[model samples]
Target: MKITFLGTGTSLGIPIIGSKHPVCLSKNSKDKRLRSSILIEKDQKNFLIDCGPDFRYQMLRSNHERLNAIFITHEHQDHIGGLDDVRPINFNMNQPIPIYGLRRVIENLKKRFFYIFSKNKKSNVSKISVYELDDYKNFFIVENYKIFPLLTWHGQLPILGFRIENFAYITDASHIPFQTIQRLKGINILVLNILRKEMKHSFPFMLSETLKITQQICPQKTYLTHISHTFGFHEEIEKQLPKDVYLAYDKLIIYE
Candidate 1:
């Protein structure tokens, strides 16, 4: 299995518009991030996790011709904004792309992209099939992968984190319930989200809290995602992290 970090920044990504923060102003390419997303490929099957606003560019850069499915973590625009851009894939495959998410998230997608869901839709709109996921109680099969949806919380909103075999991906989580943590145990690679070095009321994990959780789960390798410019330059943060953990950057690929 191979995993690609398509985009690693939080919503209003790094180098946020109109800001002059030094990290944002840095010349390093890693510092210039897009909204969070990832691509997982196993045995020629491609599964995308989140399709943020940068999805088009991320796809172009990766140059993958086919997408098997999309697994959404939540309904936030940063995570699902680029979903409409799946038209090219729909055109290539001649079928609607399957999107998996919670019932509420699926409902929100139907409301937000009503044209695509409507019977009177325009020809140009992307076609999608929604598969509602039941937290913990259900699992789905896609090609060679068996996916388990782990439930977590983003403030008051219930969101999903997915576990595929020994690899798991979780993002935008403020509090991961004990049940969810048990589901994550014994993973080979864990991708988690950390917004900054300090805590905020907005509900993303800070570096300190992330570290504590990372220690508890103890995945052989842990990659931090959904970063902000406030986390500091990529190179400096990389040096400070524990050897098994890393700050994910756009286009970074990991194999398991």
Candidate 2:
């Protein structure tokens, strides 16, 4: 299995518009992030996680040739905005891409992108197939792999985190339930989200809280994503992280 960090920045992304943040002004490419997303490849099949607004650019940059499915973490715009960009894939593959998400998320997608689902939809509209996920069930099969959905909390909203074998990916998460923690127990590679350094909000994990969770999960290796410029420069913050934890940058790839 190969996992690629397509984008690792928060909703607004790094260099937030015209902000003067030093991290944003840095010359390092790692400091420049698009939005949060990832590409997972196994058995020659590619699966995408969270097609945020930057999806098109990320795919182009990576030169991706195939995408079998997309697993959504939540209904937030930063996570689902790029669904429309799947048109090219739909055209080339001649099939609607299967997208898995919670019931609310599927409903939101239908409501937000009604044109895509409309009976009178234009020929140019992207094709999509919705798959409602039930958190209470065991892992489900997709292509050549089994996917387990981990129910987690992103503020007051319920979201999903996915577990495939010993690799788990979770983003836009604030609180993870005890049961979800148990599900992640034996993960060898854990991808988590840490929005910033401060803990003023509960919508996203702060650096301190992320560290505590990392210790508890105790994955052989942990990669932090959904980062913001507030977390500081990629190199500087990296120096502060524990040896087993890493700050994920766009395009970073891991193999198992």
User: Which ten-residue region of model 2 has the weakest summed lDDT?
Assistant: 135-144
In candidate 1, what residue range of length 10 has the lowest lDDT sum? 135-144
Q: How many residue pairs clash in each candidate?
A: 0, 0
Clashing pairs in 1: none
What ranges in model 2 sit over 4 Å off?
A: none
Tens digits of per-residue lDDT for model 2, 167-252: 99999899999888888998899999999888577599998888898888899999999998998989989999988999999999
Q: What are the per-residue Cα lDDT tens digits for candidate 1 across 1-256?
A: 9999999999999899999999989999999899999999988889999989999999999897579999999999999999889999998899889999999999999999899899976578988999988757677888756899989899999999999999999999999888888888899999999988875656989998888888888899999999989999999999999989999999899997
Q: Whose lDDT is greatest here?
A: 2
lDDT of 2: 0.92
Candidate 2 lDDT for residue 24: 88
Alpha-carbon RMSD to native, per candidate: 1.1, 1.0
Report how far off residue 115 is in candidate 1 (Å): 0.2
